[model samples]
Target: MRFDFEGKTALVTGAASGIGRAIALELGASGALVVISDLDAEACRSVVEEIAANGGNACVFAADVSDEDAMREAVEFAQRKGGDLHMAVNNAGIGGPSVPTGEYPAADWRRVIDINLNGVFYGMRWQIPALLRAGGGSIVNMSSILGSVGFAKAAPYVAAKHGLLGLTRTAAMEYAQQGVRVNAVGPAFINTPLLSANLSPETLEALAVMHPMGRIGTPEEVSGLTCFLLSNRASFITGSYHLVDGGYTAP
Candidate 1:
Protein backbone atom coordinates (compact mmCIF):
# COMPACT_ATOMS: atom_id res chain seq x y z
CA MET A 1 0.00 0.00 0.00
CA ARG A 2 1.19 3.54 -0.62
CA PHE A 3 1.90 5.74 2.41
CA ASP A 4 2.99 9.30 2.83
CA PHE A 5 4.70 10.26 6.10
CA GLU A 6 5.26 13.91 5.42
CA GLY A 7 5.97 15.92 8.56
CA LYS A 8 6.15 12.72 10.57
CA THR A 9 9.16 11.55 12.58
CA ALA A 10 10.12 7.96 13.35
CA LEU A 11 12.78 6.26 15.46
CA VAL A 12 13.96 2.80 14.51
CA THR A 13 16.23 0.75 16.75
CA GLY A 14 18.71 -1.80 15.43
CA ALA A 15 18.54 0.08 12.15
CA ALA A 16 22.15 -0.39 11.12
CA SER A 17 21.18 -3.32 8.91
CA GLY A 18 18.74 -6.12 8.29
CA ILE A 19 15.04 -5.71 9.01
CA GLY A 20 15.51 -2.54 11.03
CA ARG A 21 17.42 -0.89 8.23
CA ALA A 22 14.69 -1.77 5.78
CA ILE A 23 12.06 -0.24 8.04
CA ALA A 24 14.05 2.96 8.44
CA LEU A 25 14.53 3.31 4.73
CA GLU A 26 10.88 2.60 4.02
CA LEU A 27 9.75 5.26 6.46
CA GLY A 28 12.24 7.79 5.21
CA ALA A 29 11.34 7.21 1.59
CA SER A 30 7.74 7.76 2.50
CA GLY A 31 8.67 11.23 3.82
CA ALA A 32 9.16 10.75 7.56
CA LEU A 33 12.15 12.40 9.18
CA VAL A 34 13.73 9.15 10.34
CA VAL A 35 16.09 8.53 13.23
CA ILE A 36 18.31 5.52 12.61
CA SER A 37 19.62 3.87 15.76
CA ASP A 38 21.87 0.94 16.56
CA LEU A 39 24.89 -0.06 18.67
CA ASP A 40 27.46 0.90 16.04
CA ALA A 41 27.79 4.59 15.30
CA GLU A 42 29.38 3.96 11.92
CA ALA A 43 26.76 1.49 10.82
CA CYS A 44 23.96 3.83 11.86
CA ARG A 45 25.61 6.65 9.94
CA SER A 46 25.74 4.49 6.85
CA VAL A 47 21.98 4.00 7.04
CA VAL A 48 21.61 7.75 7.41
CA GLU A 49 23.59 8.26 4.25
CA GLU A 50 21.52 5.73 2.38
CA ILE A 51 18.34 7.51 3.41
CA ALA A 52 19.79 10.87 2.41
CA ALA A 53 20.92 9.49 -0.92
CA ASN A 54 17.35 8.44 -1.61
CA GLY A 55 16.22 12.03 -1.16
CA GLY A 56 14.73 11.15 2.21
CA ASN A 57 15.49 12.77 5.57
CA ALA A 58 17.28 10.75 8.24
CA CYS A 59 19.75 11.05 11.13
CA VAL A 60 21.80 8.64 13.19
CA PHE A 61 21.45 7.89 16.87
CA ALA A 62 23.86 5.35 18.27
CA ALA A 63 22.70 3.66 21.45
CA ASP A 64 22.50 0.24 23.03
CA VAL A 65 18.87 -0.76 23.38
CA SER A 66 19.67 -2.95 26.39
CA ASP A 67 20.66 0.14 28.35
CA GLU A 68 17.57 1.87 29.80
CA ASP A 69 19.20 5.27 30.04
CA ALA A 70 20.61 4.99 26.56
CA MET A 71 17.21 4.05 25.18
CA ARG A 72 15.63 7.12 26.73
CA GLU A 73 18.36 9.30 25.33
CA ALA A 74 17.80 7.79 21.90
CA VAL A 75 14.13 8.68 21.99
CA GLU A 76 14.95 12.18 23.12
CA PHE A 77 17.47 12.50 20.36
CA ALA A 78 14.78 11.72 17.78
CA GLN A 79 12.49 14.32 19.27
CA ARG A 80 15.19 16.93 19.17
CA LYS A 81 16.31 16.08 15.64
CA GLY A 82 12.98 15.39 13.96
CA GLY A 83 10.72 17.79 15.89
CA ASP A 84 8.54 14.91 17.14
CA LEU A 85 8.41 11.16 17.62
CA HIS A 86 5.40 9.84 15.72
CA MET A 87 6.49 6.28 15.22
CA ALA A 88 8.96 3.77 16.67
CA VAL A 89 10.21 0.32 15.75
CA ASN A 90 11.89 -1.62 18.55
CA ASN A 91 13.82 -4.25 16.60
CA ALA A 92 17.15 -4.71 18.35
CA GLY A 93 17.84 -8.34 19.28
CA ILE A 94 20.41 -11.12 19.34
CA GLY A 95 20.42 -14.89 19.01
CA GLY A 96 22.07 -16.54 21.96
CA PRO A 97 24.34 -19.59 21.85
CA SER A 98 22.77 -22.62 20.25
CA VAL A 99 22.43 -25.02 23.15
CA PRO A 100 19.63 -27.07 24.59
CA THR A 101 17.53 -25.36 27.21
CA GLY A 102 18.94 -27.59 29.97
CA GLU A 103 22.50 -26.79 28.97
CA TYR A 104 22.08 -23.19 27.79
CA PRO A 105 24.76 -20.84 29.01
CA ALA A 106 23.29 -18.64 31.73
CA ALA A 107 25.22 -15.58 30.61
CA ASP A 108 24.15 -15.91 27.02
CA TRP A 109 20.56 -16.43 28.10
CA ARG A 110 20.66 -13.26 30.20
CA ARG A 111 22.23 -11.29 27.40
CA VAL A 112 19.64 -12.40 24.87
CA ILE A 113 16.77 -11.58 27.21
CA ASP A 114 18.37 -8.23 28.01
CA ILE A 115 18.54 -7.21 24.38
CA ASN A 116 15.51 -8.88 22.89
CA LEU A 117 12.91 -8.54 25.65
CA ASN A 118 14.13 -5.94 28.09
CA GLY A 119 15.35 -3.70 25.35
CA VAL A 120 11.83 -3.53 23.93
CA PHE A 121 10.46 -2.56 27.32
CA TYR A 122 13.05 0.14 27.63
CA GLY A 123 12.15 1.43 24.20
CA MET A 124 8.45 1.49 25.09
CA ARG A 125 9.15 3.16 28.41
CA TRP A 126 10.62 6.09 26.57
CA GLN A 127 8.76 5.82 23.30
CA ILE A 128 5.21 5.68 24.66
CA PRO A 129 5.53 8.97 26.48
CA ALA A 130 7.12 10.62 23.51
CA LEU A 131 4.32 9.34 21.26
CA LEU A 132 1.75 10.66 23.69
CA ARG A 133 3.45 14.02 23.60
CA ALA A 134 3.39 13.90 19.83
CA GLY A 135 -0.39 13.61 20.18
CA GLY A 136 -0.35 9.84 19.78
CA GLY A 137 1.52 7.54 17.41
CA SER A 138 2.27 3.92 16.62
CA ILE A 139 4.82 1.30 17.68
CA VAL A 140 5.88 -1.99 16.14
CA ASN A 141 7.80 -4.42 18.36
CA MET A 142 9.65 -7.10 16.45
CA SER A 143 8.92 -10.64 17.55
CA SER A 144 9.53 -13.93 15.73
CA ILE A 145 7.86 -17.13 14.65
CA LEU A 146 9.47 -18.40 17.82
CA GLY A 147 7.15 -16.10 19.71
CA SER A 148 4.31 -18.49 19.00
CA VAL A 149 6.21 -21.74 18.67
CA GLY A 150 9.24 -23.28 20.31
CA PHE A 151 12.62 -23.76 18.71
CA ALA A 152 15.24 -26.28 19.73
CA LYS A 153 18.55 -24.88 20.98
CA ALA A 154 17.11 -21.36 21.14
CA ALA A 155 15.42 -21.24 24.52
CA PRO A 156 16.44 -17.66 25.30
CA TYR A 157 15.46 -16.23 21.95
CA VAL A 158 12.14 -18.03 22.00
CA ALA A 159 11.34 -16.92 25.51
CA ALA A 160 12.26 -13.31 24.84
CA LYS A 161 10.17 -13.12 21.67
CA HIS A 162 7.23 -14.62 23.51
CA GLY A 163 7.56 -12.05 26.26
CA LEU A 164 7.31 -9.23 23.73
CA LEU A 165 3.76 -10.24 22.80
CA GLY A 166 2.54 -9.71 26.34
CA LEU A 167 4.30 -6.39 26.59
CA THR A 168 2.90 -5.21 23.28
CA ARG A 169 -0.64 -6.19 24.17
CA THR A 170 -0.58 -4.62 27.61
CA ALA A 171 0.79 -1.36 26.33
CA ALA A 172 -1.72 -1.28 23.51
CA MET A 173 -4.64 -1.82 25.87
CA GLU A 174 -3.43 0.84 28.26
CA TYR A 175 -3.03 3.43 25.54
CA ALA A 176 -5.66 2.36 23.05
CA GLN A 177 -8.01 5.06 24.21
CA GLN A 178 -5.22 7.55 24.69
CA GLY A 179 -4.08 7.64 21.04
CA VAL A 180 -0.95 5.50 20.82
CA ARG A 181 -1.25 2.15 19.05
CA VAL A 182 1.12 -0.74 19.80
CA ASN A 183 1.54 -4.04 17.99
CA ALA A 184 4.04 -6.84 17.44
CA VAL A 185 5.30 -8.33 14.18
CA GLY A 186 6.36 -11.98 14.05
CA PRO A 187 8.66 -12.95 11.20
CA ALA A 188 10.02 -16.34 10.32
CA PHE A 189 13.76 -16.62 9.64
CA ILE A 190 14.65 -13.80 7.28
CA ASN A 191 17.85 -13.47 5.28
CA THR A 192 19.46 -10.94 7.56
CA PRO A 193 23.10 -10.41 8.46
CA LEU A 194 22.52 -11.91 11.89
CA LEU A 195 21.09 -15.07 10.35
CA SER A 196 23.99 -15.29 7.90
CA ALA A 197 26.58 -14.75 10.63
CA ASN A 198 25.16 -17.50 12.79
CA LEU A 199 23.93 -20.16 10.40
CA SER A 200 25.76 -22.06 7.71
CA PRO A 201 24.33 -22.01 4.21
CA GLU A 202 23.25 -25.63 4.50
CA THR A 203 21.59 -24.96 7.81
CA LEU A 204 19.82 -21.95 6.39
CA GLU A 205 18.64 -23.98 3.43
CA ALA A 206 17.28 -26.62 5.74
CA LEU A 207 15.50 -24.00 7.74
CA ALA A 208 14.11 -22.50 4.55
CA VAL A 209 12.52 -25.83 3.67
CA MET A 210 10.78 -25.77 7.03
CA HIS A 211 8.63 -23.00 5.62
CA PRO A 212 6.02 -24.15 3.14
CA MET A 213 7.15 -21.46 0.70
CA GLY A 214 10.45 -23.35 0.25
CA ARG A 215 12.54 -20.24 0.82
CA ILE A 216 13.48 -17.67 3.42
CA GLY A 217 12.03 -14.13 3.55
CA THR A 218 13.58 -10.72 3.25
CA PRO A 219 13.90 -7.51 5.32
CA GLU A 220 11.89 -5.46 2.84
CA GLU A 221 9.05 -7.96 3.04
CA VAL A 222 8.79 -7.49 6.77
CA SER A 223 9.26 -3.75 6.44
CA GLY A 224 6.20 -3.54 4.23
CA LEU A 225 4.00 -4.82 7.03
CA THR A 226 5.79 -2.66 9.59
CA CYS A 227 5.44 0.59 7.72
CA PHE A 228 1.77 -0.16 7.10
CA LEU A 229 1.24 -0.56 10.83
CA LEU A 230 3.05 2.71 11.45
CA SER A 231 0.79 4.58 9.08
CA ASN A 232 -2.76 5.81 9.52
CA ARG A 233 -3.85 3.01 7.24
CA ALA A 234 -3.70 0.67 10.25
CA SER A 235 -5.54 2.93 12.63
CA PHE A 236 -7.64 0.09 14.03
CA ILE A 237 -4.78 -2.39 14.32
CA THR A 238 -3.24 -2.53 17.79
CA GLY A 239 -2.48 -4.84 20.71
CA SER A 240 -2.02 -7.83 18.41
CA TYR A 241 0.54 -9.86 16.50
CA HIS A 242 0.84 -10.13 12.71
CA LEU A 243 2.96 -12.68 10.94
CA VAL A 244 4.95 -12.39 7.72
CA ASP A 245 6.35 -15.90 8.02
CA GLY A 246 5.91 -17.42 4.55
CA GLY A 247 3.46 -19.91 6.04
CA TYR A 248 6.06 -21.08 8.53
CA THR A 249 3.37 -21.22 11.18
CA ALA A 250 0.58 -22.54 9.00
CA PRO A 251 0.89 -25.91 10.58
Candidate 2:
Protein backbone atom coordinates (compact mmCIF):
# COMPACT_ATOMS: atom_id res chain seq x y z
CA MET A 1 0.00 0.00 0.00
CA ARG A 2 3.03 2.27 0.12
CA PHE A 3 4.06 4.52 -2.75
CA ASP A 4 7.06 6.77 -3.02
CA PHE A 5 6.04 10.38 -2.47
CA GLU A 6 9.35 11.31 -0.92
CA GLY A 7 10.06 15.03 -1.02
CA LYS A 8 6.63 15.58 -2.59
CA THR A 9 3.74 17.49 -1.09
CA ALA A 10 -0.03 17.05 -1.12
CA LEU A 11 -3.10 19.05 -0.13
CA VAL A 12 -6.19 17.21 1.06
CA THR A 13 -9.49 18.91 1.77
CA GLY A 14 -11.79 17.44 4.44
CA ALA A 15 -8.70 15.85 5.92
CA ALA A 16 -10.07 16.24 9.44
CA SER A 17 -12.11 13.06 9.23
CA GLY A 18 -13.36 10.02 7.38
CA ILE A 19 -11.99 9.04 3.97
CA GLY A 20 -10.06 12.29 3.63
CA ARG A 21 -8.29 11.70 6.94
CA ALA A 22 -7.35 8.22 5.85
CA ILE A 23 -5.87 9.52 2.57
CA ALA A 24 -3.94 12.21 4.41
CA LEU A 25 -2.48 9.70 6.82
CA GLU A 26 -1.51 7.33 4.04
CA LEU A 27 0.04 10.07 1.96
CA GLY A 28 2.05 11.25 4.94
CA ALA A 29 3.13 7.74 5.74
CA SER A 30 4.29 7.36 2.17
CA GLY A 31 6.72 10.24 2.72
CA ALA A 32 4.83 13.23 1.36
CA LEU A 33 4.45 16.32 3.48
CA VAL A 34 0.71 16.77 3.83
CA VAL A 35 -1.43 19.86 4.10
CA ILE A 36 -4.52 18.95 6.11
CA SER A 37 -7.43 21.25 5.27
CA ASP A 38 -10.92 21.55 6.71
CA LEU A 39 -13.40 24.14 7.97
CA ASP A 40 -12.51 23.59 11.62
CA ALA A 41 -9.00 24.62 12.60
CA GLU A 42 -9.01 22.44 15.69
CA ALA A 43 -10.05 19.32 13.83
CA CYS A 44 -7.48 19.94 11.11
CA ARG A 45 -4.78 20.32 13.74
CA SER A 46 -5.83 17.07 15.35
CA VAL A 47 -5.19 15.26 12.08
CA VAL A 48 -1.86 17.04 11.82
CA GLU A 49 -0.99 15.81 15.27
CA GLU A 50 -1.91 12.28 14.35
CA ILE A 51 0.32 12.43 11.29
CA ALA A 52 3.14 13.93 13.31
CA ALA A 53 2.83 11.29 15.99
CA ASN A 54 3.16 8.67 13.31
CA GLY A 55 6.38 10.28 12.06
CA GLY A 56 4.73 11.97 9.10
CA ASN A 57 4.96 15.63 8.20
CA ALA A 58 1.74 17.61 8.08
CA CYS A 59 0.21 21.02 8.76
CA VAL A 60 -3.30 22.35 9.22
CA PHE A 61 -4.96 24.99 7.07
CA ALA A 62 -8.56 25.68 7.94
CA ALA A 63 -10.71 26.96 5.10
CA ASP A 64 -14.26 26.68 3.89
CA VAL A 65 -14.06 24.98 0.48
CA SER A 66 -17.21 26.76 -0.71
CA ASP A 67 -15.23 30.02 -0.79
CA GLU A 68 -13.14 30.39 -3.94
CA ASP A 69 -10.69 32.80 -2.36
CA ALA A 70 -10.26 30.55 0.65
CA MET A 71 -9.56 27.52 -1.52
CA ARG A 72 -6.97 29.42 -3.54
CA GLU A 73 -5.35 30.59 -0.35
CA ALA A 74 -5.28 27.05 0.94
CA VAL A 75 -3.34 25.88 -2.11
CA GLU A 76 -0.95 28.79 -1.78
CA PHE A 77 -0.54 28.07 1.90
CA ALA A 78 0.42 24.49 1.19
CA GLN A 79 2.97 25.53 -1.42
CA ARG A 80 4.47 27.94 1.09
CA LYS A 81 4.86 25.13 3.58
CA GLY A 82 6.01 22.37 1.25
CA GLY A 83 7.79 24.25 -1.51
CA ASP A 84 5.55 22.62 -4.16
CA LEU A 85 2.19 21.02 -4.74
CA HIS A 86 2.44 17.57 -6.28
CA MET A 87 -0.96 16.20 -5.39
CA ALA A 88 -4.40 17.31 -4.30
CA VAL A 89 -7.45 15.45 -3.03
CA ASN A 90 -10.60 17.52 -3.21
CA ASN A 91 -12.64 15.62 -0.65
CA ALA A 92 -14.54 18.29 1.25
CA GLY A 93 -18.33 18.09 1.00
CA ILE A 94 -21.65 18.18 2.85
CA GLY A 95 -24.87 16.19 2.76
CA GLY A 96 -27.82 18.45 2.18
CA PRO A 97 -31.23 18.03 3.77
CA SER A 98 -32.65 14.51 3.68
CA VAL A 99 -36.07 15.62 2.51
CA PRO A 100 -37.42 14.46 -0.87
CA THR A 101 -36.86 16.54 -3.99
CA GLY A 102 -40.24 18.27 -3.67
CA GLU A 103 -39.44 19.32 -0.12
CA TYR A 104 -35.73 19.87 -0.59
CA PRO A 105 -34.94 23.41 0.51
CA ALA A 106 -33.60 25.70 -2.19
CA ALA A 107 -31.01 27.12 0.17
CA ASP A 108 -29.88 23.65 1.12
CA TRP A 109 -29.57 22.65 -2.53
CA ARG A 110 -27.40 25.66 -3.29
CA ARG A 111 -25.27 24.92 -0.24
CA VAL A 112 -24.71 21.34 -1.35
CA ILE A 113 -23.91 22.27 -4.94
CA ASP A 114 -21.61 25.03 -3.74
CA ILE A 115 -19.64 22.77 -1.46
CA ASN A 116 -19.64 19.49 -3.35
CA LEU A 117 -19.39 20.78 -6.93
CA ASN A 118 -18.10 24.31 -6.81
CA GLY A 119 -15.64 23.39 -4.12
CA VAL A 120 -13.96 20.84 -6.37
CA PHE A 121 -13.74 23.40 -9.14
CA TYR A 122 -12.22 25.95 -6.82
CA GLY A 123 -9.74 23.45 -5.48
CA MET A 124 -8.63 22.41 -8.97
CA ARG A 125 -8.56 25.97 -10.28
CA TRP A 126 -5.74 26.76 -7.90
CA GLN A 127 -4.28 23.30 -7.64
CA ILE A 128 -3.69 22.95 -11.37
CA PRO A 129 -1.44 25.98 -11.45
CA ALA A 130 0.41 24.84 -8.39
CA LEU A 131 1.00 21.46 -9.99
CA LEU A 132 2.22 23.11 -13.15
CA ARG A 133 4.66 25.10 -11.11
CA ALA A 134 5.92 21.80 -9.76
CA GLY A 135 6.17 20.51 -13.34
CA GLY A 136 3.37 17.94 -12.95
CA GLY A 137 1.01 16.40 -10.40
CA SER A 138 -2.21 14.53 -9.76
CA ILE A 139 -5.70 15.23 -8.43
CA VAL A 140 -8.46 12.98 -7.10
CA ASN A 141 -11.96 14.45 -6.85
CA MET A 142 -14.24 12.64 -4.43
CA SER A 143 -17.48 11.56 -6.06
CA SER A 144 -20.13 9.09 -4.89
CA ILE A 145 -22.23 6.16 -6.08
CA LEU A 146 -24.97 8.73 -6.43
CA GLY A 147 -22.87 10.32 -9.15
CA SER A 148 -23.78 7.49 -11.53
CA VAL A 149 -27.14 6.46 -10.13
CA GLY A 150 -30.20 8.11 -8.66
CA PHE A 151 -30.54 8.34 -4.93
CA ALA A 152 -33.82 9.14 -3.26
CA LYS A 153 -34.05 12.53 -1.55
CA ALA A 154 -30.51 13.51 -2.60
CA ALA A 155 -31.12 15.58 -5.68
CA PRO A 156 -28.41 18.15 -5.13
CA TYR A 157 -25.77 15.70 -4.04
CA VAL A 158 -26.52 13.44 -6.96
CA ALA A 159 -26.39 16.25 -9.48
CA ALA A 160 -23.18 17.63 -8.05
CA LYS A 161 -21.45 14.26 -8.12
CA HIS A 162 -22.46 13.67 -11.73
CA GLY A 163 -21.10 17.09 -12.54
CA LEU A 164 -17.76 16.07 -11.06
CA LEU A 165 -17.31 13.35 -13.71
CA GLY A 166 -17.68 15.90 -16.47
CA LEU A 167 -15.34 18.26 -14.69
CA THR A 168 -12.80 15.57 -13.97
CA ARG A 169 -12.86 14.27 -17.53
CA THR A 170 -12.56 17.70 -19.12
CA ALA A 171 -9.80 18.72 -16.78
CA ALA A 172 -7.98 15.51 -17.54
CA MET A 173 -8.24 16.11 -21.26
CA GLU A 174 -7.18 19.72 -20.95
CA TYR A 175 -4.24 19.01 -18.67
CA ALA A 176 -3.15 15.55 -19.70
CA GLN A 177 -0.54 16.84 -22.09
CA GLN A 178 0.46 19.45 -19.54
CA GLY A 179 1.52 16.81 -17.00
CA VAL A 180 -1.47 17.10 -14.67
CA ARG A 181 -3.77 14.11 -14.16
CA VAL A 182 -7.34 14.42 -13.01
CA ASN A 183 -9.65 11.60 -11.91
CA ALA A 184 -12.64 10.85 -9.68
CA VAL A 185 -13.26 8.34 -6.90
CA GLY A 186 -16.78 7.12 -6.28
CA PRO A 187 -17.39 5.38 -2.98
CA ALA A 188 -20.55 3.65 -1.91
CA PHE A 189 -21.99 4.17 1.55
CA ILE A 190 -18.94 4.33 3.73
CA ASN A 191 -18.71 3.63 7.43
CA THR A 192 -18.04 7.26 8.15
CA PRO A 193 -19.51 9.63 10.67
CA LEU A 194 -21.45 11.35 7.92
CA LEU A 195 -23.44 8.25 7.12
CA SER A 196 -23.70 6.82 10.62
CA ALA A 197 -24.85 10.06 12.18
CA ASN A 198 -27.51 10.63 9.56
CA LEU A 199 -29.03 7.21 9.08
CA SER A 200 -30.95 4.92 11.41
CA PRO A 201 -29.90 1.30 11.82
CA GLU A 202 -32.80 0.19 9.65
CA THR A 203 -31.82 2.57 6.93
CA LEU A 204 -28.18 1.55 7.12
CA GLU A 205 -29.08 -2.10 6.85
CA ALA A 206 -31.20 -1.38 3.85
CA LEU A 207 -28.32 0.42 2.24
CA ALA A 208 -25.95 -2.45 2.95
CA VAL A 209 -28.31 -4.81 1.23
CA MET A 210 -28.29 -2.60 -1.82
CA HIS A 211 -24.60 -3.32 -2.28
CA PRO A 212 -23.53 -6.63 -3.75
CA MET A 213 -20.88 -6.94 -1.08
CA GLY A 214 -23.55 -6.87 1.60
CA ARG A 215 -21.52 -4.47 3.73
CA ILE A 216 -20.30 -0.93 3.86
CA GLY A 217 -16.72 -0.05 2.92
CA THR A 218 -14.15 1.38 5.26
CA PRO A 219 -12.39 4.71 4.79
CA GLU A 220 -9.03 2.98 4.51
CA GLU A 221 -10.29 0.95 1.57
CA VAL A 222 -11.12 4.08 -0.38
CA SER A 223 -7.91 5.76 0.67
CA GLY A 224 -5.91 2.89 -0.76
CA LEU A 225 -7.28 3.52 -4.25
CA THR A 226 -6.90 7.27 -3.87
CA CYS A 227 -3.26 7.03 -2.93
CA PHE A 228 -2.62 4.70 -5.81
CA LEU A 229 -4.21 7.12 -8.23
CA LEU A 230 -2.02 9.89 -6.91
CA SER A 231 1.10 7.80 -7.19
CA ASN A 232 3.17 7.29 -10.30
CA ARG A 233 1.76 3.79 -10.31
CA ALA A 234 -1.31 5.26 -11.96
CA SER A 235 0.57 7.56 -14.28
CA PHE A 236 -1.32 6.27 -17.29
CA ILE A 237 -4.68 6.61 -15.55
CA THR A 238 -6.79 9.75 -15.78
CA GLY A 239 -10.21 11.04 -16.73
CA SER A 240 -11.81 7.88 -15.32
CA TYR A 241 -14.01 7.15 -12.34
CA HIS A 242 -12.86 4.36 -10.05
CA LEU A 243 -15.55 2.84 -7.88
CA VAL A 244 -14.88 1.71 -4.34
CA ASP A 245 -18.60 1.14 -4.06
CA GLY A 246 -18.89 -2.53 -3.12
CA GLY A 247 -20.27 -3.14 -6.61
CA TYR A 248 -23.28 -1.00 -5.88
CA THR A 249 -23.41 0.29 -9.46
CA ALA A 250 -22.59 -2.97 -11.23
CA PRO A 251 -26.19 -3.60 -11.97
Q: After superposition, how far is residue 178 of candidate 1 from its true place, in Å?
A: 0.7
For model 2 the local lDDT of residue 184 reads 97
Cα lDDT tens digits, model 1, 1-251, are 77999999999999999999999999989999999889898998999999999999998889999999999999999899888899999998988788998999899999999999999999999999999999999999999999999999999999999999999999999999989999999999899998998889999999999999999999999999999999999999999899999999998
Cα distance off (Å), candidate 2, residue 22: 0.4
lDDT of 2 by residue, 1-57 (tens): 579999999999999999999999999999999999999889889898999999999
Backbone clashes in candidate 2 total 0
lDDT (Cα) of model 2: 0.95
